[model samples]
Target: MIGMGNPRGIAGRPLRVLFLVENAPVPGDRRVWNEALTLAQVGFQVSIVCPKWGYPGFYEERQGIRIYRVPLPSLGGIAGHLVEYLIATPVLFLYTALIFLRDGFDVIHAANPPDFLFTIGRVFKWLGKKFVFDQHDVVPEACASRWSGIRMRLTYAIASWTEHASYRTADIVIVPNESVRRLAVERGGIDPARAFVVRNAIGLAHFRDAQPRAELRRGRRHLVFYAGVIGPDDGLDQLMLAARHIVAKRGRQDIHFAVLGDGDCAPQVKQMSQRLGLGDVVEFTGWVKDDRLIADYLATADVCVVPDPKTPVNDLCSMNKMVEYMAMGKPVVAFDLKEAQETGGGAALYVTADGHAGPEAFGDGILELLSSPGMRESMGRIGRQRFNEFLAWEHQQASLLRAYQTLLGYPSVLVA
Candidate 1:
């Protein structure tokens, strides 16, 4: 695969950047939206290519940025992802190729793995476009989550290989956290200078920093909140078990647990919550819009939770909800993953990582935090401070800009 090593004549041209995304729409994705808006604000001509969703037909140019959407086969299950990739990849390449043919782009910023867009990036590279690989998910871990058989095993092997190739091809590789940054250097054989860590952070300015809604917290005895995707990797069952433990062992009926956001395991998680006799206290909100998230849930919560299963992949990757929770200045309780501890620091009450820690320890941790408002407030303070210092989007924006500045100065471009 041909990759962009360094860009020539990329500086001072209002970088004609093409951002390629997998499933989500342009404006809807928080990270991608953040990047697009930031780049546009900084005088770059940004165009996002993604799958068509509920938004208007095909092309749109809103807020001095162009967004191009192509029809993908499906957005549902594994079958849908496969179908979407099968059709979407070709259409994506052709659409991008047309754009390249018409107006040569300065940079091709591709986000992924599923890693489908590497082929497109390779095609563009042959035509002299600079390639930037934004690593989102660890493909091998995702593969391990879904598959157990030989077929999936082979697919996993191929995806892993492709991931490495993406790193080798990229002029600059960006990962969300330092752990993945190390992987890009060690596994991908990329230079340390070429790898960047652009973390997932809350746009602190955008999130409504209102007083925690006492009204929402009033009717409930205690409010326990969990947000983000309910995927297999996210260990929702453990959270349910903790809910059950809270009710059965501790007789803690005063606390109500709200699970927000939907994923593959949503239905089963709901069933498990119900079966655990948390019929009243345990609830699911299922993919609330961002505005609703701020207004209805996060603004009112007493405590936030992120219960990703402790896996090799999770330990290395950072969870954005934890950062979001910190952005809102809410105390958090999560399973003890190394990165969580690093990001959360003393801000979160970490439950043990033992398989059993899912429910019982979660119950204990939440109860401990709930019992001490002073401690919760302190944790929240430290968390918000940490957000400002390290994890906010404004900070990441600098790194993103720097990476581009470096690439844009390739080959005889003065380093002024």
Candidate 2:
């Protein structure tokens, strides 16, 4: 058992931490939730400021952490995103001030997609609070992947500025993987000593002894699964095209694909699935919140696919879905992404596509895995073993706590 004995501040009081999140709500954003729970478990006073995202309350306490929710507008497209950030920036600032005055905090830990939370961190830093920037995505590359032309260029320029600003403002920067840690130092020009790779991982308790339900397969002989956001850059369009190839081009009707999670491009991806005449073969479950239901879906799948295409952003960022698939003891089929390979190691079958012919190769990889149950079983065993040894939250939590230990001036000790 891992021990994080009582963590106290220099003043002999519990170190209070306030997490700033823009993209997703508290608890729904599992990484932030896990971080908060980890700190709270070790006697840190943890609080969160994030969007309500349909949760009713403006403020609530759950599992020993306090959550302050703000109702932010959900906007899309480049211009819409700009307007949304312009609106959200001030609203989040106001909420942060309210939290500061009410509960008080020692550190502001901000997670990014917008990367504009550095503005808040800067403000808090002026008020004698340390700032930790949790870099979730490479904002400039993400912008470039999502849009193009003069507008995209403008967005990319602005994103680059905010990303640099975030790196400069953060007292310590926490990244999801080593790829991003290198970017933080090289691209953002942050000091190497100030950066930490916390990794996107979950505790094994979430997946322990999960049972598959045959009914989740929908009477199909084989089930293929895809989970995580269905964004434009997320390669759902490619998945849809692959589904078309599997059912139409290959004349395979025995395999059914289930897609979980929702995002900005969900409606468009669903429309494309219909347009490609893959309605019977593909099912979209639209963001399953129930852990048991999600577990059942993952457990029932014969082969799991990470359809995130090779993009500037995708190649660098470590996908949470890939790790989740590994945690569930499932074999994966993903594009030949750098970080995917780093996380999957020998556990996943990486597919390479030439030019725009990615969907065909992706489909072939899925079919290859589906055809060989012995290979799938071997890959699954490898994945679970890897998760248990290295990628599990039990291991990653040590890095997280060590980052905090360094930040808070606690005596550094091996966490595991």
Candidate 3:
């Protein structure tokens, strides 16, 4: 075991950390941003190297953390993804080297989707730097969910290989949920003692001060909110179908559906909504960055929906939106996914099935929630309580810090 005999680092200097993220940008990627802030609060020098998607500039310092952004092309499809990864890996490596030469980092904390960050981590490990592999998603499963035929098989094989490579290269592994932790141990063959579960939870201060904007309902009697990425695998198309069923079939004109956030499938989703005659009842507010606005939408929401259909990836991965809805004291309607059930507990109503039947069932679940004010209130209370007790970022911080303490060779210190 690597031992420093001190919490900071060898000789009592503050331990420096460099976060390598290829999927998303800093601050925008709430999970990484939350982790960064938590480590910074404990006196660790933190820096992030990520893609410049929504955020501009090459570099910036925010709240004592340094962020280095690389401009990357927004691409799609199997071939595009291959080209994108090939381009991203080397550019990100260059930034990592630059950060090491200038500021220096004791640990290379790499979050994965492409799972290729381990290649860079392996090089740094040779130079005596620690690697913490933060598995954000099951890449192989995600590839399967997004593609089919030869492309799916090829991508899955490559993803599986890279994922295992990442697990083997890491000094410590951090997962978002127990399902992922189990995968890391059993499938990736990592030691159980070295893997940690640090959920993608919201901070306590999140939405603490924002008031509900009733006006956001937009003259409707009830508001149903859905937030996060609108990818094809995310089941947004199913959600639009649900909206059509509610409005056209059930004749429930009293309810309005608000979708916040954008993704690769945003245009397709919008087109479906229009084609289904849901333009009036459904509002697509693409990517609301303002915290207060998001808080307002959630606070005013009668019910929040997680339309992620049952798939290998969706079943195993935790959804951040579900927890966020719970944090706002809003009951959720989600598919009966394993991690979703674990995360939601009694806070959500799970709809079973997939395809056309799934959306119909999902619509029925929404209607059931809308029909009973008392049930919604009770479920909301339960969700909020659960969030406060076990699912908040405050609770997850201890595990994250413990993982770092173990990796850096310091005795575990209580976080808060």
Each prediction's RMSD over C-alphas, in Å, is: 4.2, 1.6, 2.2
**Number of the top-ranking candidate, with lDDT as the measure:** 3
The models' CA-based lDDT, in order, is: 0.79, 0.88, 0.90
Give per-residue CA lDDT, model 2, range 1-416, as digits (tens).
Answer: 34355676667888899998988998999899989998998789999999999688988999889999988987898878989999999998998898899888999999998899999989888888999999988989988887889978899999999999998998899999999999999998888877889889888878666688988888899999998998878899989988888888888989999999999999999999999998888999898888888888889999998888888899998888988998888999999999999999888999995666889888988999999999999999999899889988878777888788777767655444
Clash count in backbone of candidate 3 = 0
Error of 3 at 201 (Å): 0.4
Candidate number that wins on TM-score, 1 or 3:
3
Our model 2 lands, by Cα RMSD against the true structure, at 1.6
Ranked by lDDT from best down, the candidates are 3, 2, 1
Q: What's model 2's TM-score? A: 0.97
Q: Estimate each model's TM-score.
A: 0.90, 0.97, 0.97
- Whole-model lDDT, candidate 2? 0.88
Worst 10 residues of 1 by lDDT: 1-10
**How many angstroms is residue 147 displaced in model 2 relative to the true structure, after the best TM-score fit?**
2.2
lDDT per residue as tens, model 3, 184-284: 99999999989999999998779867677878998999999999998867889989989998998899999999999898899999999999999988999
Candidate 2 residue 384 Cα shift, in angstroms, is: 0.6
